[model samples]
Target: MFSKKWMNKSTNDYWDKISNLKKTIENADAIIIGAGAGLSTSAGLEYSGKRFFVHFSDFADKYGLQDMYSAGFYPFETLEEY
Candidate 1:
């Protein structure tokens, strides 16, 4: 479980981390950034509980999808099903 403070922290913390890491990114000469759920979460796109359920209820009602992680695996019978 995460500490309550983790969620309550100012959004600036995310930018601060990115700013502090710029030197490493520059040193590595990174050309492209690969982003996924973790990166999104760090930048504040976390989904869980009511938020997750609310956003993905279509997948849940049709195919019993409980989360986006599982929704990615769902095999649909039609494009509309997705």
Candidate 2:
């Protein structure tokens, strides 16, 4: 299982937090963007619902896997199951 390092993380309301983020970005002399796989997913680019059903119908039928996010953590009994 993963550690709970984020257990104490908190955030303000969306508008307030986004406004501050926008200001911070605008005022920065340099900005860095990380291209981690989950970044786009976290920003709402999900592979779920109809997309998941279309691509992984077999997984859905066999294991009731609903979404790509959950599938990553699913303990399939075998590699073929995965």
Candidate 3:
């Protein structure tokens, strides 16, 4: 979690954060980047629009859900149903 000190920081503060990050990365032995939904979506694994309609049309009709992300927030009565 970020602290309130990070909020409303000046340009110099941003540069300081970036410099610290650069040093940390430079001194690191290894870095593991965790790519999530945004990465996959950017790589064409979209969860909405045509793809969502194609794969999840039935769920959309049954549950009134729009897309995969919205479906995750659906109030399914059971985990199996979800």
Worst 10 residues of 3 by lDDT: 1-10
Model 2 ranges off by over 4 Å: 1-33, 42-44
Q: What are the root-mean-square deviations of the candidates from the true structure over C-alphas?
A: 10.6, 10.7, 7.2
* lDDT to native, each model: 0.73, 0.84, 0.87
Q: Arrange candidates by lDDT, descending.
A: 3, 2, 1
Tens-digit lDDT track of model 1 for 1-82: 7666646667586897878788777788557877768888888675556877788776677777777777777788879856
Native-referenced Cα lDDT, model 2 = 0.84
TM-score of each: 0.48, 0.48, 0.55
TM-score of 3: 0.55
Provide the global lDDT of candidate 1 against the true structure: 0.73
Candidate 3 lDDT over residue span 1-82, tens digit each: 7676656667786897899999999999999999879898788886778889898999999999888898999999999998
Query: Model 2: per-residue lDDT, tens digit, 1-82?
Result: 9987766544553678889889999999999886986888888787789989999999888888899889988998889866
What does the lDDT read for residue 46 in candidate 3? 64
Error of 1 at 24 (Å): 12
